[model samples]
Target: MDEDRIMESERHQIEQIRELDLEELQVEEVENLHGSSDDDTSGRAYRDEFTFDAGLASLHTYLGEVEDTHHRLSFLDSGAILNLPLFYLEGVVLFPEATLPLRVIQPNLIRSVERAMSLVDVPYTIGVVRIYRDSFDGRLRFASVGTTAEIRQYRRLEDGSMNVVTRGLQRFRVRRRWIDVDGAPCGEIQIIQEDLPLRIPRDAFGTLPPLTSVSSPGPSHPTMSNTSHIKRQKCREGKNDFDADSEDSFESELSLKEMRLHQSAVESCYGCDTIDESTSSDDEKNVFESGGSQDSVTVGRSSQSNYQRNTSDALGVGRKAISQQSSHKQEKTRMDWIIMRQTRSHGVPRAFWPFWVYRMHDSYCLARKAADMWKTIVRAPSMDGFTRKPDILSFYIASKIPVSESTRQELLEIDGISYRLRREIELLENFDRVRCKNCQTVIARRSDMLVMSSEGPLGAYVNPYGYVHEIMTLYKANGLALIGHPVDEYSWFPGYAWTIANCATCERQMGWLFTATNKKLKPKYFWGIRCSQVADDMR
Candidate 1:
């Protein structure tokens, strides 16, 4: 009876994710539940295999080609000190490459939209700025950096209100602001330069030379012209074959010798034993086998990688060649590394979509940083992978991070993609120590953060009356007690009931938890913490 009871309890605790139900969730809502797929490399155990749609299917028609920079530039171009209608928002700041949805009902905003649509030179363009109320004066203040939003779609409602969707085009500084004759706020703005696109020179990389480059055939090695001719012929015919016997012999003898030379050279440089040949060979072999191919292979090194080859395996390498070969190898590695780092740090596209991004995306430091951040937010999952484009990933992080409005606004203003990501990563690392603002009592650890919504941990959810509620969600609370019975009405998580929870120590309202009433449903319960309530010391 006790074993059965324990099994029952375990079943109730296990959260079963329903992959099919993801289609019903909004893009932002989905982001709240799952961190960027980049968390897989974090080395955590909570690696939940999830597929997200991002709900961008509808925007296919409206998303302009990124390569057509001229098209977007035309819409955003403005001389310094030009006047434009403004749309003011509270608790929200838009970034370039992000999407914002708005409803125009107020007379001032409606006029602004109309005036924008009427403009011939720059139609459907408006300035979006965030308003913050000063604590001392209790007056609203606008941020300096605002984004230019281009209206992509619009609809007229029966009540004469306009429902419009806008995509952020460019970042601009608010040079000045004035109230228009029609009671709308207008701004004189200066366009900010978009960060330079990272581009790598394709010609700098040479095709893979024949694997025979490392053969120990004394001075009898084939010349470069002969090798090049054979490779070119194979490419033309598209029927290249490698005999297993030859490959096996090369691996056991030539490869081993090359590795020995590399290991010895490294040891000599650092004055310490760097790698053991037999042991390292087994591991390298396993990695090579799992990696599955030698063609198109590029080797990368890092300060943290367990092993690095000096690339000193030329044919007929003698005692005198070791120093010269090592020097050449070192120089080559340095140059290749510099090129790779330059390409990756800028997040430039090297090849075609998806595949190219994956091919060149190897920032070991960035990957390790992401992994550490994942450890703070959730306990088990390692960072799986991140989006190819840094800007897209930046917006996703801005939308999902469980930080206050001011913090998110600060993130929005950062022009550098890598800088923004690094800042968020820092926030994640420090946010682990969550404490009560009033008493400094620890409420929940970062691991307790559970993604309950599709929009991410923090999202701006509109209520029935169109009032937007920016919420930060968490999974479970350590120092909170449930106040009342679960309420079903207007609950965001479908099929679940919400109950208010408060801090046990201070008796202050913290957040709520949604519980599944259905016995068969997985994730019997999860918590949602208000971003406003929790104190993030990192801020």
Candidate 2:
């Protein structure tokens, strides 16, 4: 009886996610600070995913065949400054290469879309900036750092609203913002030239023995012929073909002092680790501490990982090469590390590094590491294809990583690709739990997450009041209280009826519960937790 009771409780607790519902669920009534009780108005303001018109998807129709320095199509070919229609969304923090879908209903925004589409010289480009309310003051503030979105497709609705699909192109700094005469949000923005991916040259990096041999493509490890090198990893043993933990072999080869220097260098660049404990804010300290080991695959500890083994083997990096480093170096340190070269470079470009010093913080290494970690965390499409394009890989990971908006915003504001990739690697290493932002109550484990949309585990969707809400789907959650009765009205997930969900401890609205509206739907119920209200938590 007790066992049966426990199983029933687990099911009710949402510990198990039912099978996926492949059908599209159009829901509008998202309860938020912006939700309204008006039925007619709700239909226009809030919307869900819809099929896009294939004819309108061609970029050549709206834009000339102009290319930016990065090889991406852009309206501005030569100038650093671009005047674009700006969107200050409540919860959207777009990163480069990410896709943002919007249901435009407001007259001002609709006009802005039309204007962008109609322009001949620099058409279909809009600045997507994040606007958030201050917790202390409740005032709306716009982020200075934003991404330029290029409209890819659009369809006009009968009610005069438009469904738009936009892909982020570049990160820019807002120089000026104003409501145009047409009432659209417009900004004069300075395009921030992104730092190209940098890595320690192969000659400079020759001192270290290879861990995995599959070379990585890109500028990271250039050969004499300028051919790309392959890179792979060993994520410990299991599932995959390789069983060697190459990280173990790689770390043991480096001199103790060299490893320490590398660790310190990585910490300083990643932030908070080099932070003065006495002066650092509580939030900063908490973030660093949470990054500590919560599970076997920890940030600092050397644990059995199938990821490292598989990656190392594929790279053609042999265990023999890794074991040979001890012959050159005298001291063996207790610590195990995988990256960085020097403790300090004093703002010098990586390209200027003297050849004698070993280069460990190669952007490619970080990118490959991050991609491998991403694979281990979620069952998504492979990130191996991105390991070569470290810059895009960094942004792609930043866009889809299952964390809070504020964390994603921080990624958008970061300057260099290596720096951004390092930060993402750390976040993935420490990402484990979801907690209430206000009261810090544990809500769910990372393993409990579900991907309801192709965008990823977390996605931005609009509410009835034209506010974008970034919500993450989960099979089960704890310390949550369901508010109001379940209602299918304007449901976001078509087969699921949503019920308001709040943190039981603080009574703060966390997100919602979506119960399968149809009995045949695999997952009888699921939970949608607002990413804004959840925090990256420690175990």
Candidate 3:
């Protein structure tokens, strides 16, 4: 009887909707449909093992991975130039180590999947590019950079449609593209070579001299961490932060003048006199490989070349001399190894460069910071393994962090792990507001976000129309006016009925308000907002 009533009610609702005509329905019609003026559309935000507030937990899903699995999968050779099948999507940017689920309804789309599966040479892979509509001429546009999706799972629907779960394997730059006779898009792709972590070795830490006693009040330079400062001090001795504590050796006993003269002698012998402190890093040139509004990520060959160019003017001096100077600075100037490994000075080493080198720009250091920031924001899983491996952590966070599509696309185009992690740390720190991408209205705040799944607060879900929406669940939302009657059919969240939610200010449909069918269930209501429809208002 309950099922029958539900069926009859749904039929009546559909008839009413047809009568109202969705195109012409307005807020007044919505009010008439609900038949009530009462409005307490907000919900009791979620709570989970990770957080006391469901909104906070939901926010964690956006910060952390939606579906995390430890795998050792392989990819196509980075050195090779290969032609692969293409799967063009709208407003989607796939990152490496990320999962993309596709629901194919069209015949050509199904054939495209079939063709990809039939390939026996490599894996079932296809280049996924984002296609966007232009405003000026209403023409189609696509990005040059894209990710290769490897079909991890596939199934056929009873209606002859196909469903595929693909994992993004590698990032590629498309050299050329064309459509085949079978109507499948294809691309000639070259895999981008990603950089490894710039980590300080364990031996570097182990080989340093142990501190014993401070020598006759040496210059009080800064130390790395306070813990190192405490360990190296003979006693607490009224010291808390780091200090340049070295033993009472002959070098310390020498007059400051004599030491300077000796330093001059060493530089003269090496032909590195007056070496600019800035031009001495392993690769210390700034090479930006980017277009408008795009941030570049590199100091590779180009930087090495720039470094050589900067030093070429110093007739007899070369990289060997600078390396020696850098090593000398490491061995003589700094000693709080326990506090941390050191990077040198481009500036005061305070706000910009801690003691001046771009050492903080190292992938390993950035990894630690990014991980800590993530943990601090949403105290959930253990990221000890990621701290050791920066590359994996960098990609993992890039895939999960709920920012705008353009922001994520920028991450996909980035080449270096350190640069990527640095950008991610910035995003994670400033992640607060969710607003309308079109009108920039404040639709929700970070406190209202809820983690309904392991994937994180925001995730991709395909509608019955075959359009994929990256939706973030929230315990509550504001400035939203409910539209029409709530419908339960094909709802993303089970047992929750959905009604279109439009921005009350601009009347733009931003997302849907979900209300539970069973009154006994917690949250009684929630909201699922489209990530693409929202912007990150850092302000």
Candidate 4:
């Protein structure tokens, strides 16, 4: 009986939707059609971990494959060019490691899917790109960089449409595009090279004492986690303890002037010479005197290039000349032996890459950086060290981070693992800088924002009659005033009443504020700001 009632209600709602034009339907009409004037939309906000984790795991597994596996399973060869079916989406950008759920209802889109499925070898692969609509002439423009979508699962509907789930496998740049006879857009594509983590050269700047020898310290830097700082220190100290016994006789002969020059060179390389004397620690001085302690180098994202450049220059006249050539050669040989043994022990193919490359791949370091990036995406108050493979972490951030489409697209185009991680770190660190669009006034920081939707801080929620509304949620705003009385009827969030919030200075409708009708609700009040209203370009 209950099922029958639900069916009847749904049938009635559909009839109402058909009678009233979708564009013309008012908010009251929508509520009446769905019989949801008393409905609380808040229940849908809570996320289930099982679904999220399963999806994440699938993506991780797909992207975590080795280079050879990716090659064997690839749908297209590197140089081979072919026209493939294209699907253009709005307000969405797909990354190579993400999965996109699509509904194919239009005749052209359905035909495109059918054509792709008819292929013998790789029946599921198709080209997916973003379409940007112009504000002036209202013309659609396709993005140059697009991803190849591999249809993982699909179901045909009675209406000849299909529901499909696809994973993004590789990035391709469009060479040319044309409409096919069936009205489906097809594109000739060139595959973009996959970005992998690079090996740090043992002598990155040839003959330069690695930055690890430098000693000048205080509190840990923001770019690296505290745990990494401690681990790096402990590892360096352990190595130094062994070297101390061997170097004791040689250390006694070194002049104080040479030691001072080495320390100065390290300081210059780290851009730490500007530090005040009062802030320098006695512990730091002791470490520098020991000549074995590795203390100063904390190469964060922004300073990686700088550290490389300065270290090359610092090598000049800093203990290298005075150190016996035979002793240096022995040390280099020992390092080579250790690297070779590691390569052989791992059974990594010698043909795959050079020994030094594998050493610099440094899985442990890359994993730590990936963990930090994950913490940023989830908006954790502090770093939560969840180790993930670097490639998986890159795709996770690219797919999950709640930034503007343009920012996400920029991340998609970036090619190196280290560079991509750095870019994500920069974006996450700067997520809060929100300003007004028209007058260039400071509005609200990301810290003050509260995400009330599953989609994220910014989300698109469609009404019962299929009207799409893009909404951004925030906790506070600087120059906005509320208009009209709070309405409890048909509130999106349960047990809350909403009032119109408009810019106090410009008087434009910014968004709304939802306050709990039930005093016991956890979030007493929250704001939903429109992305179109706020200025994201701080510059």
The candidate that wins on TM-score is: 3
Lowest-lDDT window of 10 residues in candidate 2? 338-347
lDDT of 1: 0.52
Query: What tens-digit string does per-residue lDDT give for candidate 1 at 454-481?
Result: 3445554432232334556554456666
lDDT of 3 at 77: 76
lDDT of 3 by residue, 1-539 (tens): 12234334444554465565445434521222222222322322134322223333322222112232233347777756888889888767787767677778878778887887777665477789877656589677888889888876666778987667677888899899998888878889998887767643221223333222232322234344543544455355533223334322433433322333333332222221111332323323323221223211121232234434443354244334445454544334323221122221111111211212354455676787899887665443788898888998988888777677778778888888878998898888788877887778777666666666566666666555466667777766777787666776666666667777777777666777877787665566677887656764544
Q: Give the lDDT of residue 19 in candidate 1.
A: 33
Off by over 4 Å in 2: 1-79, 203-360, 536-539
lDDT at 404, model 1:
61
> In order, how many clashes per candidate?
29, 40, 20, 0
lDDT of 2 by residue, 1-539 (tens): 12234224333333223221343323333332223232323322221222222222223122213233232354443238868888888667898877776768889999998887766656777889998777799788889999888887676767887777678888899999999898999999988887666654543434443222322223422332431111223122111223223434545554433343333433333332122222222133211221124211112322124334444453454444445546433221322121111112221123333322322356766777788888777656787788878888888888877788888899999988878988888888788788898899888777766666666667665543345567777666777777445665445566566666778787777888877667666455667888778774544
lDDT of 2 at 97: 78
Q: C-alpha displacement of 440 in model 4, angstroms?
A: 6.6
Q: What C-alpha lDDT values do all the predictions have?
A: 0.52, 0.60, 0.59, 0.52
Better of 1 and 2 by lDDT: 2
Deviation of model 1 at 519, angstroms: 5.8
lDDT (Cα, 0-100) at 63 in candidate 3: 17
Structural RMSD, model 3:
15.9
Model 3 / residue 530 / CA error / Å: 1.6
Instruction: Estimate TM-scores for all models.
Output: 0.52, 0.58, 0.63, 0.52
Output the TM-score of candidate 2: 0.58
Instruction: Give residue 7's lDDT in candidate 3 (0 to 100).
Output: 32
